[model samples]
Target: MQFENTREFARQLDKEDKLSRYRHEFIFPKVNGKEVIYFVGNSLGLQPRSAKKYVDEIMKDWAELAVEGHFYADKPWWDYHERFSEKLAKVVGANPSEVTVMNTLTVNLHLLMVSFYRPSGKRYKIICEEKAFPSDQYMINSQVRFHGYDPEDAIVEIKRREGENNFRTEDILQKIQEVGEECALLLIGGVNYYTGQVFDMETITKAGHDVGAFVGWDLAHAAGNIELKLSEWNVDFAAWCSYKYMNSGPGNASGCFINKKYHNKKDIPRFEGWWGHNKERRFLMEPEFHPEPTADAWQISNAPILALAPYLASLEMFDEVGMPALIQKRNKIVAYLEYVLQEIDKDVESTFEIITPAEQEDRGTQLSVFLHGEGRELFNYLMEQGVITDWREPNVIRLAPAPFYCSFEDMYEFGQILKKGILSKQKV
Candidate 1:
């Protein structure tokens, strides 16, 4: 991983990358028809070219087969959804039966909340990070209110110590123990959207289970960004969107996970739909619900086969390169990014701080930079220079070097652009 300089280092690294072949699989963003250095895969991944072909297959199925496509056509649209469960499960570290594709992120969170976040009168509280994504916060708030409880009282928000930007594991474990008596469920983002902080799910799950509480995770930022073992971690339930690191396209169908332990539990109240019924009896149209004994029981609607097409294509790429192999490259790329940020003139580097946890295990693909004094104009300047990243108002600009498409040369170019932008802003 040693480098003589940025550009030469890029060609050398690309030479050694096992996943290097994946670069051509995607279509990068264009600015005035030129390729822009896209680092916002943490927000929206670059689309794969095969996505169109995947869609075309479904289109042909619809057009040629017409009404017969549902059950009698090749691959049978009626069971097409089943084809991907095994592939997706490989990515998220779950069994095929323990996963299902369905509604979008926030909607799936709401559906999972219906079955997992059962709050009783005395022990009714959700412990979540204070700076969680707005959609997750809103979902938790509305769910609390739906249960006839005040969000202010029912949602326990965790944060770093005063004047701190991130929460430490010790603090999180201590807080869970302190409030374990009242907490009904633990619902946290697998990775913080703004800070790029990756929570230790195994420890968090164990802490909640120790307190006799259910645990769930919002994997909007974690899935495809980091290696996850949801099944081995024994997480009770989880939901994630695929548009970001998953590269499924904007607002693509989301995937959800429910621990197999909950599948046979008769007491866990689920908001059931026909799609979640046992496949053996799905077409029976029986009045009584016969729920599947796996995460598929969480499904409330049919899979969006058209919307999920990109998932299949993108996942196929992961399968070819392997998830761990891609992550290995990201670890080096992200560390290089952090190094470049720190190498800027001391005065300039001090002007903004990277809020992402420094440890390799504590973050995924994103680096959330908090502007120390200059405010957001620096982010705008970078954008104007075609270094397309996402700015979360107030002060944070999230930079993500997606392994599938981002290059070391892109990161190097970004550093020069960033330094130039900061220098220009400082002169003002």
Candidate 2:
């Protein structure tokens, strides 16, 4: 795809896209009354226009039906949490029972830790990336300390080679081999928030198991952006937020998974609540905590139905497109984006670097561009001009071409914005 300028290229690509109609379903923000090129879905996805109506139903249920709403209504408020369960399962490649919607991301991460991270004398250390999402760092550190151990000693962080911006597969595998005997849990991001790098989950999961450790992942960035099979991967457990690529509203509900392998384990220690009690006799309120046999068994309380509505609406669209097909679309779109970014980087020579992997399979929709000497200035200039990409700390700009809605031309335009933004500096 050759282009004279981003606008013309975008129009042509949109015309050829099978998913072009999806753009109309979303509410894009206006910059000076014009639609800005939105490429930051990796940070916060655009809201669906239908979200208002979806949210209104919950408001109406609470207002009109009041107490009776729980057992009444078309979808039934009593089973309201189940409304999006099946669709949520389809999005993450899980059995209906293997997935459940509940809690915020960090809260769910803690709950999963309660059930999965059982530390002991010889095998009590935790393994995670050095630059994990800050919340994850806090979550793991707290867990390590909660188990009566010092975080600095109990927690181990894997870093890239001294001068490298990303971790090599062999580096991660070697770290696991080196620490496997002492590791109690291997917790990692499904996709690194800062680098936009996707790690090999299957191999990591296998290695963790080889040394008798529980393996879990935080899919905050990867869940809706990438294709995954948590159950097939034998991942002991995982959790993710839906607001980013899922297009759920800000602070929306999160979803989690437990491989069927642990579903029947009644002895698995947990921080159980009423909602997680056996569904059939939950109303009986017996003293014994007889848990549900599925992932629903992990739920600590009823979900925020209103907060989950937009996620339901978004997951329905994913169901229509299917994850595999969406991933295929994502790979091609980002490759086009990457190709253009490289072209521009070549034009500027050493001014910037693509910190994300060059290979398609090693990332989702996101690309992290590190500016050489003045990243924040370049990023702010792009933002002022209405090129909507995200800026991480120090010197990196993160752009995600969400496959369900982001277009090839949108990716093209972001590159052009960066290129033009840099060239404008020469005239200044």
Candidate 3:
């Protein structure tokens, strides 16, 4: 499809878009009395209009029922997090029994590591991507330290080829093979936060397993933005935050996927609490912990009802629209965004080099552009003009055109604004 940098073309595309109407479901921020074209869904999603209703329901229940709300509220606060299992399983392509909602992303990762990241005398090293999200780096480093190992020896980072912006699948596979028996675990972000590259999880998971290593993914960016089949991939475990593409509020609850093979295992070690106990026998309060025979076995505490409320609200929308529809729009819109960037670059003296993978399958909704011959002034101009985007160090701006709310018109308008910002700088 030929993409044109014109309002009419953008409007025509939006008119044909089946997902266009869903944009109204969200509330956007204003800059100078107009709704901004939001491009930072990779950072934080816009608030779902239904989020307040979800939260208010919980608030009303707490007011009316007091402590009894745990058992009698409309959602039943004691089992609130259970509501996410079915819907979230669909989103991440896992069985309902294999999925659960619990603590925040990094926290869940830490908890999951208790079971998946076991290291022994001869096999203690972990393989991860080079320059992983800072939080992940910190988590891995701390986990290794807690296990009494130096990060320098225990962490094997798969570096990108010297001058490349992304990791090659062969390089990743080769590194996994090289790590061999020493590799206790192989975990990497499903969607790279920096270059927006989508790794080949199925193949990588198989490679990890073949090498006698546990494999998992940090799906912070991949959970709702790209296609995932955690169970089919035979991933041992995975975790993702709901506040990004999932459209839950800030620092909201996270979703986890644990393979059914790991369920009800007596040998598997985990950090457990009352919520993970058998529901029918939980009130008994026996001293021994009998974990629930599913992913909930990883739960360390009771569900945070208020936090899960907005997440449930967003999951309902995902169920209604389905991932196939979202991915369809995502592919077209991201391509159109790339086309707009190219067209705008042609008009301006500055060059916009999209560091993200060119193939649709190798990328998701985000395009990380290397703004050559430009600086922070352009980013500031964009922000002031209500173009909400994310700025990384060294003149890179991450633009994620979230399919549910972002529109083709936003892409075209952003191109215009970008051209103006660049030309304005040249005149100075």
For candidate 3, write residues 1-428 as lDDT tens digits: 87778999999999999999999999999999999999999989999999999999999999999999999988899888888889999999999999999989999999999999999988999999999999999999999999999999999999999889999999999999998999999999999999999999999999999999999999999999999998889999999999999999999998999999999999999999999999889989899998899899888898888898988888999999999999999999999999999988888888889999999999999999999998898899999999999999999999999999999999999989989889988998
Q: Worst ten-residue run, lDDT, model 1?
A: 343-352
TM-score of each: 0.95, 0.95, 0.99
Task: Tell me the alpha-carbon RMSD of every candidate.
Answer: 1.7, 1.7, 0.7
Task: State the TM-score for model 3.
Answer: 0.99
Please say which candidate is ahead in lDDT: 1 or 3. 3
The models' CA-based lDDT, in order, is: 0.84, 0.84, 0.94
- In terms of lDDT, the best-performing candidate is 3
Q: Rank the candidates by lDDT, best first.
A: 3, 1, 2
Winner by TM-score: 3
What would the per-residue lDDT of candidate 1 be over residues 1-428, giving only the tens digit for each residue?
A: 55534677767777877777778889876776768888899888999999999888889989998878788766677677777788788888998888888889999889888887888768898999887888888889999999999998999988889888788888888889988778899999999888888999899899999998899999988888889899999999898998999899998988898888888777888888988888899989899988888777777777777887888888888777767988899898898888777766463744668888889999889998877776677777877777898888778888999999888878778888888887777676
Candidate 3: C-alpha lDDT: 0.94
List ranges where model 3 is wrong by over 4 Å: none
TM-score (C-alpha) between model 1 and the true structure: 0.95
Evaluated against the true structure, the overall lDDT of model 2 is: 0.84
